[model samples]
Target: MKIDWAAIGSVIGVSLSVTVGLVALFTLGIAGLSRRERAAAEGNGGGAIAATGAYVCFAACAAAVAYGIYLIMAKS
Candidate 1:
C-alpha cells in the first residue's frame, strides 16, 4: 500500500497547532484569574474586567472540548 505522506503531515500539523492553542488559551484563563485576585487585593476596579475575561476564556476552552467530543461521537 502507498503511504499518503502529505495527508499524514497535514494531520500531524493540525493536531499540534490545536493542542498548543488549547494549552495557551487555558493558560491565559489562569493568568487572568491570577490578575483578578491581585487586583482585588489591591482594592481596584480592574478585577471585574479580569474576571470577565477569565470566564470567557474558560467558556471557550470548555466549548472546544465539547466540540471535539461531539466530533468523535458523531463518526460521520
Candidate 2:
C-alpha cells in the first residue's frame, strides 16, 4: 500500500483549520462571558453561575473539536 501524502496533508490542514476556528469562537464566548461576569461582580451580583456555565461550554467545544480531529485522522 502507498501513502498519499498530499491527501493526508489536505485532511490534516482542513481538520486543524476547523479546530482552530471553533476554538477561536469558544475563546471569544469565554472572553465575553468573563467581561459580563466581572461587571456583575462589581455590581454586587453573583457571577459564579455564569462563569461556571461559560467554562462548561468551553470544555464542550474543546471536546467537540477533539472528536472532529479524531474523525479526520481516522479517515482512510
Candidate 3:
C-alpha cells in the first residue's frame, strides 16, 4: 500500500494540537480542583462536579488524540 505523507502529516499535526489542548484542559481541571478544595474548606459547595466533568473531558480528549496518533501510525 502506498503511504500518503500529506495525510499522515495532517493527522499527526491535528493529533498533536489535540493532545496539547487536552493537557491544557487537564491543567485547568487541576486548578479547579484546588480552588474547589479551598472553597470546600471555606464552607462552599462548588467545583466538585465541575472538576469531575473537566477530568472526564480531558480523558476523552486525550483518548481522541491517542486514537488520532494511532491512525497516523497505522498503515493504510
Candidate 4:
C-alpha cells in the first residue's frame, strides 16, 4: 500500500489557499460596510456604491460556500 504524498500535499495547498481567500473576501465585505457607514455619516453620495459592493462580496462568499457543499455531496 503506497501513499500518495504529492496528492496529499496538493490537497493541503489548495485547501489553505481557498481558506485564506475566503476569509479575505469576507473581511473586504466587512470593510465595505464600514466605509459605507462613514460615507453616510459624512453626507456623501458614494454610500450606495459601497453598499452594493459589500452586498456583492457577501453574495460571492455565500456562493462559494454553497458550491463547496455541493462538491462534497456530489457523486462521481
Top candidate, metric lDDT: 1
Model 4 misplaced regions, further than 4 Å: none
lDDT of 4 by residue, 1-76 (tens): 9999999999999999999999999998999999999999999989888789899999999999999999988954
* Worst-scoring 10-residue span by lDDT in model 4: 67-76
Q: lDDT at 40 for candidate 2?
A: 87
Task: Return the clash pairs for model 3, or none.
Answer: none
TM-score of each: 0.95, 0.54, 0.54, 0.92
Better of 3 and 4 by TM-score: 4
- Model 4 global lDDT (CA atoms, 0 to 1): 0.93
CA deviation > 4 Å runs, candidate 3: 1-8, 65-76
Positional deviation of residue 44's Cα in model 4 after best superposition, in angstroms: 1.1
Q: Candidate 4 versus the native: TM-score?
A: 0.92
* Candidate 2 worst ten-residue window by lDDT: 44-53
* C-alpha positional error of residue 62 in candidate 2 after TM-score superposition, expressed in Å: 10
**Decreasing lDDT order of the candidates:** 1, 4, 3, 2
Cα lDDT listed for each candidate: 0.94, 0.78, 0.78, 0.93
Give one digit per residue, the lDDT tens place, for model 3 in 1-76. 8999999999899868876887887777777678778878898888677678667766876787688779879956
The better candidate by lDDT, 3 or 4, is 4
lDDT of 1 by residue, 12-70 (tens): 99999999999999999999999999998998888888889989999999999999999
- Where does candidate 2 clash, by residue pair? none
